[model samples]
Target: MVTFLLGFTLSVLQPVTGLRGFDTPNDAGGNITLTWESPDSGKVMVEIFRSQSPLEGYQKVESVLSSRREFVDTSAIDGIKYYYYVVSIGEDGKTDRSEILGPVSSAPQWFNTKRWNVLIILILLIIIFFIFIRLAKKGTKTYIRKIPGLEALDDAVGRSTEMGKPILYVPGLWGLTNVTVLASLSILRRVAKKTADYGARILIPNAEPLVMTATQEVVKEAYLEAGRPDLYNERDIFFVTADQFGYAAGCDGIIVRERPGAIFLLGVFAAESLILAETGNSIGAIQIAGTTSTLQLPFFVASCDYTLIGEEMLAAASYLSKEPVMLGSLKGEDFAKIIVSLLIIVGTVLATLGFTRIIELLSTG
Candidate 1:
């Protein structure tokens, strides 16, 4: 009895860490959702209970819920005044309880206007997105605040230029044909142009022949942009043997021999990430690395001065492009991220208080 009350109170409070709300859809007779954040420790278990009479008698009701936010309580009968509550049960019968969400109406919702409403919402979101795009075009910065990475590129390149050594651009192991590889090549255009302007040479040792080819085009363009096209040399952008370590060894050779001032490890990478980073560290080069590979992230974090983790790699080209599809996508991601975050906060509160039904109700609503 004591365990039930404590669970009930905490479930009502729904105290948690890292939980995010899943998208809410009303089609399921029992709408279910998930929370992104999980407990740092402890196995989280959920249970439901019911009462025809509030305090006197309550019966245990097992509810099927996802490992995430909320679940639909479809063990429900229409026109019946049913009471529902939950418990966050832990080991040894220890549990926290939630407040009842009840006497709920189980009749289908939006047997009303779903079809009509869907089109309206799509149009609204579309309009809102374009409006922001227009504002952006007029030189009106959106209300969102950011500290962009590309803005720092000049600093990275300038530092290298001052050091009187070559700059190393490694596009890692992804094939040249990948979109991200192409994006990385685009960034190299800007970086190369900056290097050329400073009269500092860049060395691009790529793992793929196709990426090597595209990179050559971009670097050539950069030199052209800086009006130093004659200064561009094919030897500066060369293909390294594609074996991971073989490529790493070639990059290492350039770092050691050419003594480059800056080393950029972009696109994709793996175990060689550490080999390259530690080498650059030894050379005292300003190393900035970006890659989408999760496994190698730790090495870049430790060795590189600036590490672009995860999707930041993809966002790099868009940011550099400053075009509508690119910038628009960037802004869209931010808005979606915000919506995702708020839902988490609410779901945690409802689940803690034994009101996970609120997650379902509010999410679907």
Candidate 2:
């Protein structure tokens, strides 16, 4: 009886069996996986523990149902050894500990092969862009569709000249950092040149100091290019308040007082877009607007005489410049869009036919 009692006590105090840990494969590192066999005696919960050293400082990392046999430790440090173990707890609070496993270290990989498709696409685009640019430099003709809003620029400027009224340009509420503002500046240069040629006054009121400075420079350059430096007025290009509504109010005041013949509202805008466009409409000003803001497009389209939507705002720079490089880049972008559209159509067809190879290839991990 004494021998049997001793053996039973030993069994009760024994640790859980068959615990194992290994480093996870095909990863950027900092991970280890632990697994264990289920306790045979009864249903129990398993607790996982980890430590930097095998013999000391083991802290519980996770608790899992008895049916689960695996845990992934994502907190492992790269280049540092880690130790782990498991404990099984019975429903009656009896606990058994597993032998610790040690010295697993995470490592980094130089490249992620999963992104190979992305790399191929990037290379192809670069090749296409360069090829088109080269062809353009060799004097290949690139056809661009006519944009009515852009085509109307000269007529707008001519009308302003005929009316003897200043042309008002608002470069939106954003600063120079925005792509839309940059495009606006490019359009501004073209407008300034037209106004200079026709000897008409052009007023550029800015909500940003940097934009004001850029406008002054661009307008002055345009005047000099047109051989009408005398017509360039520094005061006409001035900074207004940066406050959105305040800037709109100030621009409205200018519209009311100056009654510009042509008003160009281009760049990033918010609620102030409707305010400006409606005011321009009320004053009988010939308003031309363009913006990447989808919400503001309807307002411009409703209130302005002409509005350039979405890509037209981006294309304005290339269209107005007519430089070989810009034209080539634009054409390349169109080509890329066509390719992407074709791929989408093909992928859809294949997916409908129960072939998902293309879809899988395009999918990102």
Using lDDT as the measure, the top candidate is: 2
TM-score: model 2 vs. ground truth:
0.87
For model 2, the local distance difference test gives: 0.89
lDDT of each: 0.71, 0.89
lDDT of 2 by residue, 111-228 (tens): 6678788888889998899998898899999899999999999999999889989999999889888999999999999999999999999998899999999999999999999999
Listed per model in order, the count of residue pairs whose N, CA or C atoms clash below 3 Å is 23, 0
**lDDT tens readout by residue for model 1, 305-352:** 888877777777767767765576578667756765776787787799
In model 2, state the lDDT of residue 216. Answer: 95
Q: Lowest-scoring 10 consecutive residues by lDDT in candidate 1? A: 15-24
Model 2: CA > 4 A from native: 1-30, 33-43
What TM-score, over all chains together, does every model reach? 0.61, 0.87
Cα error, residue 173 of model 2, in Å, equals 0.9
